[model samples]
Target: MAEPSKSSSPAEQPRWQSGTGLAVGMSLGTALGLTVLDNLAVGLSLGVAVGLGLDALQARGSSTAPPQAAPTTPGAV
Candidate 1:
């Protein structure tokens, strides 16, 4: 039987790199503000603010996590 690989994959990218929350927040804020308020400037500003807020939150959450140990090969000293 073969052992499963322990290497990190692309899907394991850090939250900051992915920007998933920021993108969603910006899109939703802009869409709602524009359609309801009919103001592009206000809408975009709100969107950017929301995205930044989400990014900040993610950063804060990640900062408190314990550091990860470096990976080692099976036979390496």
Candidate 2:
């Protein structure tokens, strides 16, 4: 039987992209909240908290598999 493909699927993106997305979301949320509520400390704190939580969740979800080993050649020392 043919060996299965080792390539990662196109749908899977690097973990940093997800964290950056969460950071952007939090920044926007905080800006909106501050503009609407006139509170800097509350907005910043809430944004940081939400961003950290989302990053943690993303890390948890993506860590199921261990790192892959490098492929070896048949005759290389």
Candidate 3:
């Protein structure tokens, strides 16, 4: 039998994944906070927040995409 395709599985791919931006952001943020900021709580919180923010930004354009055309009504502006 042929082996399963690694690309189809998320766990197999090791490169920086677009879906993992939040995780990456959080880790980086936490690292920054712990070493430079010298605050565990702040570091963890900021890391999580940054991670969430990155996720949101990346997902912003995916769902609820902007309308292609402006309002058709004339003199409505």
- Name the top lDDT candidate: 1
Q: lDDT for each of the candidates? A: 0.71, 0.66, 0.67
Model 3: residues with Cα > 4 Å off, grouped in runs? 1-19, 64-77
Q: Encode model 1's per-residue lDDT on 1-77: one tens digit a residue.
A: 34554433435556457676679777977897779979877877888788888867766666556656666778878
On TM-score, the stronger of 2 and 3 is: 3
Superior by lDDT: candidate 1 or candidate 2: 1
- TM-score ranking, high to low: 1, 3, 2
- Per-residue accuracy of model 3 over 1-77 as CA lDDT, tens digit each: 33443232334444565558678877887898889999878888888888878767755644445534433565556
Error of 1 at 9 (Å): 17
Model 2 spans with C-alpha error above 4 angstroms? 1-18, 65-77
How displaced is residue 53 in candidate 3, in Å?
0.7
For 22-55, candidate 2 gives per-residue lDDT tens digits of 6865796689678976887777777777787776
TM-score for each of the candidates: 0.56, 0.51, 0.52
> Residue 76 deviation, candidate 2, in Å?
24
lDDT for predicted candidate 2 compared with the true structure:
0.66
